[model samples]
Target: MTASTLARRGLGVTVVERSGDTGRTGAALSVPEGLLERITGLRSEQLPRTLAPGVQSWFAVHTALHAAAAADLGIHFRENTRVVEVGQDTDAAWAVTAEGERIHADILVGADGHRSVTRRHVAPDKSDARYAGQVLWIGVAEESAIGSRGWPASVAFQHGAGYTLIGYPLPGADGSTAPGARRLGWALYDSSRDDVLRGSGALVGSVVQHTLTAPEIPEHTFEELARDARRAFSGTWRDAMVDSIRRRAVIGTPVAEYVPDRLVRGRVALVGDAAHVANPMTGRGFAESLLDAESLGAALSSNPGRGDRTRALLHYELDRLDAVREFVRSGR
Candidate 1:
């Protein structure tokens, strides 16, 4: 989205992605209503029918969120263009080599996910991706199937002590889908080091499989799972929360990591999870991504001169750094 906004405003914007397509299959995204309105020009109701409407004001729980509609803005996204290296051209414009092709642009924005290639190119001395000691398993179920009203309703939450499971409605597909087809989703959070879960994809897989067996289970079951799912840990999960999640659930793991530095040189910047990732507990990634696009676009628009633009990039980095640093601290 930021790439498109920059290009539309007359900046040379090119996006390089590793995937062959952008709309890859995955769970729906939750975005803020205002961000959606500002970017896409769509009111909440105007969002894709498939998007479920969850509470927009809460982060402790998940919901079906909307992104603003920016009809005038569209980006030509290229898939399968993995950024292998990043450097500066003699003129100081950012040069990026992806796959086998090379690209030169006035500025570079890394919207890549957590394991960002741009971060490595700009700051090779940085540490490896660190895990956030928590995992989230998400899936959608019918709203009515659960015999519940619609959005604004809390599915279930067990925030006792160290473990938690939050459930909420996300918007859904068109009429072909049922009403309560209101996306029922949940996140299972456990705190532990990644090494403890080492090579235990099978163990993680089994735990998720077990979660689906019942409509609800004691949250303590989750605490046990969290501990047994890896090496010994003192962390605990609520019992009632685990039971509720098990009743209707889909399993997933939301791994977290962050880049200590926000800016890569003067010409390159990182956004979204590529810059910093908050614990899924914050549920703020989508909101931050939209804001990032707006901030970067405004900075470039305000400072068109090379010198001013370079400084603008620095300002942009500083602004996001403050926000991301706070996000990291809050998650801790």
Candidate 2:
């Protein structure tokens, strides 16, 4: 988003992605109306609608579309490039890629996400993300499968003894909302420390990690999750839960949060999850990231050339720091 905004303002922007292509995941996300307008310069009516009201699109579609837009704006994207380290001197900041290439820029924006190397370079003493003591298991299934069981197009929430389940409709893989083509995305949150994390060996400090497609997730785990869902929910929701668990891959991750003391150091600036990682309960992670990109671009554009660039960057950090704090507080 920063690259697209800067490129639109006629600034030379290069995006370094560690992946070979725009990565796609089965997980779905809500794109807020305000973020849609700010990033695309389009109103709600002008944007593609989602099955869920007020959401612009899912994560995969948004990613692909944003990448295409950035490409059209002449932003250079260097794929298969991983930044091993970030360094800056008085004159400029630089990133050292894993391939031993030094890329220099007057300003270094660390949009590298939660495990940011740039954040380490800028604020070495900052605290790491803390686990929120909950694990989330997520999967998606065909809407038809759920609808046939009489599930309505609405958000459903169920709480068991020690778990919470949320299910909602998402557009199809191609971003379609047509009947039988839509998808149901569900997340089951379990706070009980059970065999799932222990068997996977994903407990790294406080954070637990396990992808749906990873081999560590044994088949019995899925069966257990499905069985638990059946025992917790009733009717269409229960049936849908079982079907989704049986048919789709289930991804798991420990809920975590990280709010840094500061957002800038020297010529380096942090954005998105690099600066603050709010709980998913807030449903504002992606929105906050977009706002950070917009704020950074606006700050840089307001101070063209090298003169007063540092001041503008600091202003950007200050502009967003309060909002980020509010988000973290409210989410907690």
Top candidate (TM-score): 2
TM-score for each candidate, following the candidate numbering = 0.70, 0.89
Residue pairs of candidate 2 with colliding backbone atoms? none
Model 2 poorest ten-residue lDDT run: 48-57
Model 1 CA deviation exceeding 4 Å by range: 21-29, 40-74, 92-98, 143-152, 159-162, 175-178, 192-197, 200-251
* Deviation from native of the Cα of residue 92 in model 2, angstroms: 1.4
What Cα-based lDDT does every candidate model obtain? 0.53, 0.72
Segments in model 2 whose C-alpha atoms lie over 4 Å from true places: 21-25, 34-37, 42-59, 198-201, 207-212
Each model's Cα RMSD:
7.6, 2.6
Error of 2 at 167 (Å): 1.3
- Quick one: RMSD of model 2? 2.6
For residues 99-171, write the lDDT of model 1, one tens digit per residue: 4666776777877666677777656786235655565554445445444433444445655446565655454
Distance from true position, residue 137, model 2, in Å? 0.5
Q: Write the per-residue lDDT of candidate 2 for residues 56-115, one digit (tens) a residue.
A: 235655565464465455677777899999998889888899989999988888887766
How many Å off is the CA of 220 in candidate 1?
Answer: 18
